[model samples]
Target: MSEKIFSYLEVHAVDHCNNNCRWCNNHSPFCPEREYAAGEYIPWMEKLEKKGIEYDMISVMGGEPFLHKNLTGFVLELRRRFPRKSLAISTNGFWLGEEQIESYQMLWKLTDILFISLYPNLLRGLKDGGDVTPLLHKITKHNPHLKIDLRQKQTFRMIAYSEEPVEPNTFCGTSECTTLLADGRLARCGLGGYAGYSPNVGEAFRSSKHMFFDLNRKFSKGEFWNWRRRWPFDACYHCDSYKWRETNWKAEKGKRRRLDLELEHDRLAGGRLMALGNFTQAESLFRRTAEKYPLDAALCNDLAVCVSHREPLEALAYLAKALEIDPDHDDARANLRRLRHVLGRGTENARPEVCSADAGVR
Candidate 1:
């Protein structure tokens, strides 16, 4: 049987983040945009509830979910509406002090999980110190019954870039990976906004009156998993220990301003080589270019695909490397799935039989 594709909901309460970590991919501190107001949330919640769409899991994230003044109220409302549904939140955990903890007490009663971003630099007092470990431990200790995942920065992953892409890494490719922006836009994965594309979540939801309409339109019919375009990396992608390249979209000034230019050059060169079906040479060029700019997920993804036929094991290695850098890498994940199946069927030793004239590594 095919895998069941479960649907989940993510609501971005606010886009204005408080932390100013150097590796922040969305450039949170630099993001001068704010998405929603407290009043806006209730209506959306009501709409979802009226539709009888009980989300498998409702994920609350933002520049920081706790940044919202009504965070506690929001959690309570959600719990009140969907008593049996799972609730989760991702936060920098900076405001998680005594008062905040007390406020969260009500939330903890309903929340099933809490994902705290343990960015070393985001700790308190140590330049970018905003340690959440103590807070996380405290929450867990107090609740004792709550489940928590202390997500380190290294666990994130990225897809490969087409030009100088970065190495892959390990990640859990959740079947229900999806995100909902404050504007009600839906994306295939959590990193969609960071990756530079709008999956039109809000428009889909408003038009159809059902969240599944957007989900089915984007996944089943839209083939949302395919990565054919290019986008820069965000803080989550950069903080990922497995990441290789970094795109400073905010830096549009001097010598460093032309970073995208360098990436573009490599992309063009890499594309030409790939067009000739020269996987070996293309892989070599991509490897060298990626070394200088390791954050390009698209490039890394391409190199992995090129070498898959010639060297399945090597290709698997490259795909794994690409995934390490970008966990949301749909292509790398798909390719890795295929490679694993090929290797498992004991076809690793089998060679394709081709006519001599047509067999020239076509």
Candidate 2:
């Protein structure tokens, strides 16, 4: 058995989630109903042990892990099988009510981290008016042994599939990790597991084409290593969160969005640099700003301008995102028009509806 310990291994214990969070990167609501069979994991674990495939942490996740009636049994089996590995679970905290306090106790007692995602909309409906202090107090009062991980809601980015594929190498947080889907398909990330999409690594790279393992089949050391090394795999092109890449269409237009004033400075500085024709400096500044203000159409447009001369394809993608965010963003539309023309892509049949946006200039 290899003694190498992986950083993380996420297992989707349940296919469907309790909450229909619009920004869910896992696209849980659309996922088909499926349950992870505990029995199926035993042989797999045995194989891993025999091959020395080890991990420091094992995340038992779901649309909601608690929704599974057999979760406790499965978790206990995992403890018995991988006694030295740390156990964890991620939840929305919607179903962790007073009625399930006992169950929560058993779960929290067994796991190293009880990651609770605090959705603001859900929090507002609480008896204490969205305040977590009382809830935390109640939970701790009942289960002092429980370790809580309260993750406050923020804008979560996701990329939509593009008609024209572009190779992406951005750090998508799933690098070097494995995700076991509910159907026993083990993938490097949820995108590949569900969408059959991954980065284009080349025809010779078998991992790019297969992307995951059929746990029902025989497991091997070669399969494990192949899955582990297929980072930034071809299927990655389907996910923007993999690298915070902008989508061609807006996925969150009607929803209320958040932005920070601190990022405005970077955009302004980047815009100033763009006006001076310092595209390299502007590109760096805008890139930093876009990381913080990804949904901001103005910032995306500015960044597009900065990169237009050096990387027109990237600029086209950015402009597309700008138009998607603010469909009325005329400047972005114009920039897209000009770039497409330079690229020799005809604008005659490429007309988009009028959009509203400032000229993306300082």
Per-model TM-score, in order, reads 0.45, 0.59
lDDT of 2 by residue, 24-101 (tens): 556565566567766666665665677777778888886677666567678888887888888888887654333233
lDDT of 2 at 18: 51
| Model 1 C-alpha lDDT per residue in residues 106-185, reported as the tens digit of each score | 56766788887754433332222454556667677656777887665532333232222233353423213555555544
| Candidate 1 deviant stretches above 4 angstroms | 1-4, 21-27, 33-55, 96-99, 124-137, 154-176, 194-362
Clash counts per candidate, in order, are 45, 18
Where in model 2 is the C-alpha error above 4 Å?
Answer: 137-145, 182-184, 196-210, 214-223, 245-362
Compare the candidates by TM-score and give the number of the best one.
2
Q: In angstroms, give how far residue 96 of model 1 lies from its true place.
A: 4.1
Could you say which candidate leads in lDDT? 2
